[model samples]
Target chain A: MAELTYRDAVIRGIAQEMTRDPDVVFIGEDIGKAGGVFKATVGLYDQFGPVRVRDTPISEQAILGAAMGAAMTGLKPIAEIMFSDFIAVCFDYIANEFPKSRYMSNGQVKCPLVVRTGNGGGARFGAQHSQSVENWCMMIPGLKVVAPSSPRDVIGLMAAAVRDPDPVIFFEHKSLYATKGEVPDGEIVDTLGSAKIVRPGKDATILALALMVPRALAAAEKLKSEHGIDCEVIDVRSLVPLDTKTILGSLARTHRLFTVEENPRLCGWGAELVSIAADEAFYDLDGPPVRITTPHIPLPAADLLEDIALPSVERIAERVQRSLQS
Target chain B: MAKLEDRAPAPKGSLNDDIGEEKRLALYRTQVVIREAEQRAYDLFLQNLVKGTSHLSLGQEAVAAGFAGAMRPGDLSFCTYRGHAHTLARGVPIVQVLGELMGRDIGLMRGKGGSMHLTSVEHGVMGSYAIIGAHLPIACGAAWRAQYKGAKDVSVCFFGDGTTNIGAFHEALNFAAVWKLPVVFVCENNLYMEYTPISDVTAVKHPAADRAASYGLPRIVIDGNDADVVYRAAIEAYDKARAGGGPSLIECMTYRYSGHSRADPAKYRPEGELERWKERDPIKLYRERLRAFGVGEDAILRIDAEVKREVDEATEQCKAAAPPALDILTTDVYADGGFAWRN
Candidate 1:
């Protein structure tokens, strides 16, 4: 195992994939010479040259549309939106274009495309940059949505996303990019729809994603030490083909659920999880599922105000303790 | 003014100098086949045989016929929603094209993609996008691949006059120009973008033709309704792209006889605009030109009758085709499995 940053893991995964497959090409704004604003795609431009590592105009619509086209043909294209918030600019491309072509084309064409974007709150780039919109990718049927919380999950899911036949939205948390973790030395091709129990216990179940995964884990540790609550934390690696079995099993054992997210509580991913658990494992629940999320307001620039806006470790632990008491 | 009989004159001498009677008649045959097939699709739609809405390229056959006719077999082409003519001209089988419109299992795209998304890689028709100018970048990507792989194939993107205003058009044009990719952006100016006239929507005198100069590439503004005119221009652009001279824009001035879809009747068009363009119909003009090139009237009539019969049989073939099974709906959502209905 090697200790690597989440960002470095992403670059390593891309380099290994590009080396393995000639058809895998990268396209985005400033991803070439600029090495990406986050520097995740650094050193790739020199290695792959201009044709494979393309620098595109500042039109996400065109970038994604072209990537969709190239994916339909023969290339396995990895398109990066500089920020996840800019996905709205390519609304038609995502909501209407790349997602529908495969199903709409029946079985004739395959879209082996990966849309990589940096998401999450903590970075304080304000509302435009500090947003987690994985739900947008989930709404589309053919598209796969995956968010990796650690360096290991990043490499595994990145491999799966690149290899997948349909389009996959890889939402990496910008704040977690610097977080160091132990990742396997060689190739790690993890399944997309499988959720992992980062911390397991029996008192309650806490489902978190991306940046929230670490917070949920920290809360779980605190709950065990202070309140004598044995909380199980499951990182939802892939949001689209959700790991229903793991979530249901965890809920059946814990008999309580607290879904955490950085996105607004209204119509967030937590709502979907609640619905899934309610429908499939209704009798297994001890109480109505609780949701701990950021309020439905734009992210503020000030650090203290932003801290108040988003859900914190203490807030998550208190919510779980309250759920257990109730 | 030239006499009405010789209104749609053949090109003076751009690339037409090499086009002999055989190729000229072939071009005429392609236009006839497209026109007949479009009329057949319209008739089917009227009879309630075609499901969903079908956009027929009634009078704009010359643009597709000329463009696709001039393309080499290895070349790739992408087009807009009203693209039956382009796909047909690219040599997609009549039965399969009709199967797509009729929503049958035998469609080129397995009936999933109806009229707006017909694709046949075998015929090099990449796809027909329903969005206005969304597929322009996709076409550029195909051309970029061609350049990357050291292949001689050039990519062509066909869109309407309105697509020029979209940011995708500018982005795609600028990308192709910057990289000098092997591509030909064909703008089929069919007079209107749905209900509004092109004049009301665009600011410039020539909306799409000026894009070439803006992007620092060669431009061709030709009479799109004239098959020979479009054909000559298409040949020049294709030649330039294949020679690594970078991308070029060919704006074909054409008109459509039908409404935007099956819904509108296009009552918004100005007085006598449709009739004036219709008098210089591409098929009529090409047929007269074929006669002047020493082709007998019997040859033109024979080709027309044969095409009419072919379209007639293809319509029945489409109607007879069965819809895909229920299980297929649950399947093929993902190529490399993430989530399937069984899960």
Candidate 2:
């Protein structure tokens, strides 16, 4: 096993896929030599050369369009949108072109490509650069959405996204890039639509995603040690093909649930999870499920305000402890 | 006033001498087939048999024929909602095109795509996008694929004049030019953006041709009503792209006889506009040219009759075809042949 940063995992994941298949190509702004704006794609240009690792102009529409076109014809493309917030500029492709291509063509055309974007907040890139927009993609019918919380999950899920026979939106959190974790040495390929229970417990279940996963884990540890509340932390990695079986199963045993989402409170991905639990595992819950999320407002750039806005470990533990006691 | 027919009259000189007689006849046949098929579709639409909206290429057959004829079998085509002619030009069966419009099981997309999203990958008609200018960059990607694979097949994208104003148009042109990909961007400048005149909204005289210089491409605008002229231009563009000369932008000056979609009656057109375009109708021009080139009247009449009969047969077959099964609704949403997102 090797200790790898989430940023290096992005490079290794892409290099692994490109090396495995000649059809796989990478395209984005400043990805070829500049190594991407966030440097998440560093060393790809040298490893794969110019043809496979392409640098496109500052045109999101063209980047996705070319990726879709290439995917439809033969190539398996991994296009990048510098920031998840910039998805609005090329929403037509995400909302209309890539997702609907297969259904509209009645299976004649397939867009088996990956659109990996730098997502989430805490970098103080302001409102336009730091939104968690995985919900935006998860709502779309034809797309598969996945956000990896750890270095190992990043490499494993990246392989799964490239291999899946559908358009996948890979949300790579910007703040989590510098975080390190142990990744297995050989080729790491995980399955989409599956959730991993990071820390097992018996008191209550807590669900989190991407940047929120680490926070939830910390909160769970705090709840166990300080509050005498043992909470099971589950990383809700894949949003669309959610592992509801695992979530609902956990809720049945614990009889309580809480969701930590980085997206705004309104229409957050947590809302969907809660709704599912209410419908499928209603009688299993002891009380109303709680949702811990960023407030419904533009993420402030100030460090203190941003921290206050996002669900903090203290807030998570306090909420879970108070709710479980009630 | 100069008669519209007199404007851009067939070049007084050689008529595509480089294209052989057999190839010229084939191009003529393709145009005739598109013209006849579109007329039948219009008739069916009037009877409310086609259901939903249909964008007929009533007077813009030559552009589809010329480009499709110039393309190799493996070459790809991406077109707009007004794409029946282009789809047919790529050799998709007439019955399948009609069935797709009729929402029958035998349709190109088995009644899923409807009229605007006609697609037949087997015939190299990649897709027909309804959203304006979305396919331009997509065509660039197809070209990029060919470039990456060291293949010679080119990707030809056809769109209306209004597409020149869309952001994707500029982005795609710049992308293709920068990458030096083998793609041809063809703009059928029919002088209308849906219901409005092209000049009313456009900043230049020729929407696509004027913008070519910005991308380091030569400005080319031709009479789209003349098959020979369009054919020659197509050959040059395809040859250049195939030879790794990068992309070429060609604006074909054509006109549509029908409204933007089936819903409009075309009352917005100025008086005598449709009549004037009809005078220089592509089918009429091609027929006269065929006669002048010593093609026997009997042979030309035989082709016309055969095309009419073929269209009639297709119309009959499509009318009898059933709508797709209910289960088809959930199929093809993913490559796994099922639309289930969760277990």
Candidate 3:
């Protein structure tokens, strides 16, 4: 029952988890005294000491590999990679070792690790600092992918990520960090792999994730006000263990669907969702599902170019209108 | 050899106690076991009993046997492709190990893991990854788990001198050093990363041990052919790690007598190199040390007979063991009950 930003909520969730479990520690490049580049771990170093909130070298491979090592041994580690673009540097560790350890060992080892990184392109940090690579991670098995759009969802999903027995990739949108929302003061745990209904409607469904959730909601409101379109908005909080039940249920009611994502169009998370819908809810669909996503190009440094590159509320609304008309 | 005056004093409290008669005999027996087991595996490979390639740890027996003896049951171990000896040293049953190599259903990993993928979690041997330098990160992860769980256990990762050149090794070592993780990186410098000699690839004189200082970790170089020396060095490293003194890198200078895998005949080695290494045969040296320490010849003979009998029995069991059921091919790719995301 307190107003908090997405960054503050994440910091509170990590601090709460560290307090509850001494085994939970944080590690990243500037997460210690600097409190993280986005300040997601602000005031944690002072409260938990350097051992808990560790400052690591500027080696993403080492940070991720060490986090996997720590998680497999016994500690519940929440490692930060600063930006999602840097995740490419640690792909071998994540794809080859972390995901394969449990299955290769026949359930003898479990990697209860959470890799938290800032994603999406709004601040125009160019191609390197701003990118949404959640789809790249989704291709790997044994990993759970989560992207929360709001501060409340961030806190709830993060707590669940910390407690889950599997490795989780928690992507925080760079644009959503400063966005204010009402987060529950007491402990709140949202189940992973479950979608939440952000706006209930009957005409069509707009499924979104991370920074796109607010855009989807905005599009839904605009469609209702101007075009008299009743659009349902569903926040896909977790992408890997996707809440297919909730999505299909919503699709069953709406009979039309469109997915909105900040990542590029080709082979993006939207493609996966569309495939799943085609496979499971084909008969329920009245029209081919649409996808409103960023163009298949690197995020540009200029604000105008980046704005055009990312999915916009107007574009999402237009896509909803097209899906309904089709 | 350098003069005594010229040599630096062995790091204080680093040297282990002298290997007594019983320990020396034990070391000889373990080396023989490894040699015989590896030979039998090669024989099986020739007969098509084992599928895929086999990497023999024939000449490097002293390193595996010695370090394995120093480890407690709860300590963790990760090794490279040439890992049969390390697995045996970690107390994996000869019958199960041989069965795995033979691709039998009763084998470790339920016959899924072949010669290079051997694993025995019950014995604290996580796995032996086939990829060079891949398991270093895994070892670091396990060590991090140990420290996080507040367990006193230590993790030992065994790799070849060649793996030190890989990025994964550097990443694992740097993290272990920075976080002060309880891990010991044991590099079995067998003079070659496959057919290429260490000197040809690495500019540093001591390719394995010299790299430890780069990561701010204490380094030790030892005569890998000597079981007593390897055992002492490994024990010290493991002890320091378990005591929360952070990580250490130990380079065991040894030689591989056989080909890198089953494909090559090791023709690349220069004349007299193999002979020179054989002159320092660890099993023979330990046996002589045992005899000089008053262990009866009768006792040594009895021990050798016992080990031989065990190997013979394991071979028979492996040959008789049936191939894995075809249904297992679909299993173990994901955790049982299916992945939550997929199903």
Candidate 4:
């Protein structure tokens, strides 16, 4: 076993997949000679040469469009958009073309493409560079959205996305890149569309994703040690093909639920989770569901405002407490 | 108008007696096949036998026939919504296309993709998209794959004058030029993008062909009505792309005889536009050109009769087909079984 940061695990996962399959390649800005802006693709261009680790022009549309074409023709492409916000420029290629290709062709074609983007607010990079848009992608039907909160989950989920026959949006929380964790040395494959229970408890459940997972864990520990509120934490790894079964099962046992997301409340991923739980496990709910999400406004540039804009461990705990009271 | 003797060397290869009469006749026959198929489709639509709107390629048969003929079996093709001629030229069975228009289960897309979404992966026709300039990026993607894999195959992206103004068109062209990917952008400039003429919408002097020079890619403007001219240009473009000479854009200056979709009657067209385009009708020009090249009258009649019969047979097969079952609506959304069924 090796101790790897979430970013390092992603790089290793892509490198392994590229070495295993010649069809697998990486494309992004600064990924070639510069090793990516975040250095996640360091030393790949030299090892794989220019063909596999392409240094594309600054156009996000070009990077994504090339990946889509490559995926359609018979290559497993992992394209990295420097930041999640840059995806806005290529949304047409993603929402209109990639997802609709297979269905439009009646299963005659499959886009085995992976779009890896870094998101989440915490870094001093301000609003544009640090925003979570996983909810935007989750709204699309043909896409599979995966958000891994740990090094192990990132590596495993990335490998799965590379092998998946459909297009997948693999979101990496930029704030969680340096966070180290135990990652298996050998090949690890995790199932998409399934949630994993991080900590088990019967008093209440904390459903979270990506960077929010760590906050939820912190909140869970605080509730246990300080307030004596036994909390169950479930990491929702995949947002689009959400593992509702596991979430509902946890809710049934815990009888109370609170969701934490870095994105805003209105039309956010957390709202979807609440609605799903209401429809699937409403009878099991002991109280109305609560959500700890960023306010419905653009991420603030100021440090204090940024802190206020993001959901905190304290906020998650407060929501969990509120859920228990209801 | 200039006489035949005054014309230039016809681009590259000469259309002389050295080229066999049979080959020229075969090319004409292909054009006739597309024209007859589209005419029959229009007739069916008028009679309400086919449901949904269709953007007819009535005046642009040569562009599809010529380009598809130049492509190898493995070469990829991405076309716009006005793509019936392109699909038929790429060898999708006429019956399946007709069935799709009729909304039958046996349609090309199993009745999921209607008139605008005809796809036949078997023939390397990736699919046709209704979005104006969307397919250009996708075509670039396919071409990148071909080049990366060290394959000789090339991708042909066909769009219209309307699409050239969109952001995707410029983005795709720049990427294709920078990477030197093996792609050919075939812009079927039918003068108008639906109701708006190219002159009205574009600020550039020559539209797509002129824009190619700005991107440093080779451009060729051809009389789209002349099948032989269109065929020669396609051969040159395809050869350049396959030889790893990067990308080329061919502007087939053609016209549409129908409205943009099924609903409009094309009443907004200019007074003399239809008459001017009719003078350059591709089917008639090709038929006349074939006759001038010594294709006998009897052979031309035989080709016409054969194509008409084929279209009639396809229409009959389409009418006999059934609509897709209600359950089929949910399938094919995702490769893996993950979508929720609300019903």
Best by lDDT: 2
How high is the CA lDDT of each candidate model?
Answer: 0.85, 0.91, 0.84, 0.84
Candidate 2 on B91-157: residue-level lDDT in tens?
9999999999999999999999988999999999999999898999999999999999999999999
Model 1, residue A150: displacement in angstroms? 0.6
Misplaced by over 4 Å in model 4 are: B1-19, B337-343
TM-score attained by model 4: 0.96
Evaluate candidate 3 by giving its C-alpha RMSD to the native, one decimal.
3.4
What TM-score would every model get versus the actual structure? 0.96, 0.97, 0.93, 0.96
TM-score of model 4 (first chain only) = 0.98
Query: Which residue pairs in candidate 4 have backbone atoms (N, alpha carbon, C) closer than 3 angstroms, thus clashing?
Result: A69-B141
Q: Residue B329 lDDT in model 4?
A: 74
> What is the per-residue lDDT of model 1 for residues B173-288, given as tens digits with 9 covering 90 to 100?
98889888898998888878888888897888678876578888755678887777777778887888888998888787888999889999989888998999989898888877
Clashing pairs in 3: A1-A185, A69-B141, A73-B145, A74-B145
**lDDT ranking from best to worst?**
2, 1, 4, 3
What tens-digit string does per-residue lDDT give for candidate 4 at B21-58?
Answer: 66577677778878888788889988998887888888
**Fnat of the models, one by one?**
0.51, 0.80, 0.46, 0.67
Candidate 4's residue-wise lDDT over A92-209, tens digit each?
Answer: 8778888887887778877899999999899868778888999889888789899999999988899899998889999999999889999878887887888999999999888999
Best of the two (1, 4) by lDDT: 1
How many clashes would you count in candidate 1?
Answer: 0
Return the lDDT, model 2, position B232: 77
